[model samples]
Target: MAAIMENVTFIDSSTCAILISAFKAMQLKKTGRLVLADSPVVQSLIELTRLHTVFEILPNQKSGIIGIDGRVKFAITIIGPVN
Candidate 1:
């Protein structure tokens, strides 16, 4: 899979939409990881989306992250230096 907006410094609808679209496009996989590069845009977007239930947000949005699809639940991984 390809990463977009490596480091998101500012989160916006576009980014979220892109991610959602990609996630959907990616379809449901048993094992998958979506890494969100370090960027304020990305962080802001996550805060606005309120997707903690489906994703894990790391302190630093530049380090690394993992995302998963669950029928009973959701998974999200975040990485970077800023929580």
Candidate 2:
């Protein structure tokens, strides 16, 4: 899926929805990384984890190194189905 960190904001219901969709589409069931622009203790992040149990949350500092559209809060790299 895709996420935007921008200058502020991270993890919302919509973001969670996107992740859920991605998981269903890609069949994610193993350990994965949730790259965040800031911290993973945000409300949305907490909610996301509570709803889904597939990815591990980690802080991302290489957002600048990656070319993204709009702003990004968090990003995930799922090569294939986790299961």
Candidate 3:
């Protein structure tokens, strides 16, 4: 599974923790690359948690999809803040 976090300017510690948990969970069941699109906050959090080695960090969603499927396809789900 791949997650592309965009326009996320701010993220609290608790939320970061939750994200880490979810990423880890996904990692366990992942068949392909577990990619995370670049976001300064998210990248910092991942580095802080030492999960950088666990996930494949990509520059954008398109790259992430390519990294996963080796081509661009419409096979993605975008989940964002409720507000």
By lDDT, the candidates rank as: 3, 1, 2
- All candidates' lDDT scores? 0.49, 0.47, 0.51
Which candidate leads in lDDT?
3
lDDT of 2 by residue, 22-76 (tens): 6666554554434344334453564546752454443343444333553333443
Give lDDT tens digits, candidate 3, residues 1-83.
55555556787678557656765565565534343444577677766776555544444444434335443322222222222
* Per-model root-mean-square deviation over C-alphas: 11.2, 6.2, 9.8
The regions of model 3 sitting more than 4 angstroms off are 27-30, 33-35, 60-83
Question: For every model shown, what is its TM-score relative to the native structure?
Answer: 0.52, 0.41, 0.47
Cα distance off (Å), candidate 2, residue 67: 13
lDDT of candidate 1 at residue 45, scale 0 to 100: 62
Off by over 4 Å in 2: 1-4, 28-35, 39-44, 47-52, 61-80
TM-score of 1: 0.52
Candidate 1 vs candidate 3: the lDDT winner is 3
For 4-83, candidate 1 gives per-residue lDDT tens digits of 44534455677667666655555544334465445555655666788544556554323333323211211136322232
Model 1: lDDT of residue 23: 59
Please identify which of the two predictions, 1 or 2, would achieve the higher TM-score against the true structure: 1
